[model samples]
Target: MKAVVIEQFVSNFEDLKPRDAPLPSSKKSSDIQIKVTHASLTHVDMLYAQGLHQNNKRHVKPPFVLGTEFAGIVISSPSNKFAPGDRVFGGGLGSYAESICVDEGIVRRVPGLWSNAEACAVGVSGAVSYGSLISVARLKRGETVLVLGASGGLGVMAIQIAKAVGAKVIALVGDKEKSRIMKELGADEAVSYRQRNWEEEVRALTDDGEGVHVVYDAIGAIESALKCLRYRGRIVIVGFAARGGKMEEVRANRILLKSAMVHGYRYGEDGRRDPRRTEEVWSGFLNLVEAGGIRPIIFQGNYMGLESIPRAFGDLKMHKVWGRAVLRINEDVEATKEAARL
Candidate 1:
């Protein structure tokens, strides 16, 4: 099998590449064996490669496969809920490979309308966006939301999810093109942080010209995020992708003035701690998918095979990718072709 193994933490994305590796061995009876057809490359993957992710620093070590979200066909299943040849999409580590073994609890059948690539595109980021807005922030219908990093994978999903719940969405992006793209994707309005007075522009889009009801800050713009919040508004800190991989200091005085609530969003860790809550959040997200309120916004790139991982990471870092960048692996393979490759 081919996998992107992080032999040791490197400072550059180019230093990460794929290598021929042994097939994964199942660790438990509940683990489902999947032949990965498509996988989502995320910012966290790059962070892991650079030893900057909290998970990497705390637990995960070198010589590990790097990816978390995937869509594939089941090679075998230990339970009746899934069977051999069933099309499924789910999330776990070691997805940047030809196959992965994940517990049945984390696996889900791919939604009817989505392709393998599409399911791969939304698997984890969708969960994060849905969890942050609907579960953590308690976003309500008729409320207003400002989604930072609106052109990125999570932000794109956040915009659509907020809209599906009847909330007005204001996307805060990096440029004019991203602003246009966000509006086309269901954001009620779009503001570019590149512009001077961008925070004021965001505030002016709100119902009362005070501020938005909720701010989904994925890009470490907490200071500006606070400025764009309404009284008693909710702010969900999803990530610090913009802060050069360092933590940001939030002013307590800002939180005090508005009587605001701030939540540090960590979907994966929260899911591990409370299984029931995970189920509820995932169910709500899938329901929205089934209702056609959400769709995968895949980057326009032919990222095929394991070899493309490095280039994908580079593009993601350069902001060349608009939405989730998917790598197609074994998607169109025949049994003979698979055998021939081996």
Candidate 2:
């Protein structure tokens, strides 16, 4: 198998190179062997490579495979839930390879209308959006929701998912171009955080000049978003994309003034702690995708083959990625007719 192996954490993504590696076999009865066709690139993978991700620092060691989310065809499954040639998409460690073995409990069938690249693109981000908006914030129809970092993968999915539930979405991005893109993606209004009074502008865009009912803050802008929250509103912290990935501080007074509820959402850790509930949420999200309520947005860049991984990582770090960056893994891994129909 050809795999991108991280022998040691490095400051540069260029140090990550492909090597011939041993084929991975299923270690658990519930595991399924898959031939990966495409994989998603993310900041988490960069953090892992730099030895900066909190979870990686605590649990992972050197000499491990480098990626997470993947879409592929199943080669074998012990649980009988999936058969050979079935298309599936899921997230697990060691996905930057030609093949991988993952637990069936974590995998889901790719929707009939989706391509493997699309499946790989949304595998993790879509779940994060669902968990943050639907599970944590309990976003309701007709309520106003504000999304920070509205051009990134999580932000793109958040906008669509919020809109699908009938929420009026206000997307905050870095510039006018991204703002326009978010509006086209179903945001009711879009604002550039570059504007000095963007927070106030967000509040003014809400019904009756009141604040938003929920704030989906993906870039550690909780303090700024606090200025745009309605009374008894909810703020769900998804990530610290700004401040060089360091967390931002929010004043206690602002939260108190709005009578707001603030939550730090980490989908991976939460799912590990409560698998059953995570499974239910994931199942529901898949249902939403199957019904055409949501779709993955691939960044408008050409990323193909294992060698493109470094380029994709560079784009992600530089904030050039508008949506998910997907790397084509095995060109020959085609979808079966039966799997494509379902």
Against the true structure, whose lDDT is highest? 1
The whole-model lDDT of each prediction reads: 0.87, 0.86
The TM-score, computed over Cα atoms with residue i paired to residue i, of candidate 1 is: 0.95
lDDT of 2 by residue, 203-228 (tens): 99998788999999887888888889
Per-residue error for 54 in candidate 1, Å, reads: 1.0
Top TM-score prediction, candidate number: 1
Per-residue lDDT of candidate 1, residues 230-288 (tens digit): 88999998998766668888888999999999999888778789988888888999899
Please give each candidate's TM-score: 0.95, 0.94
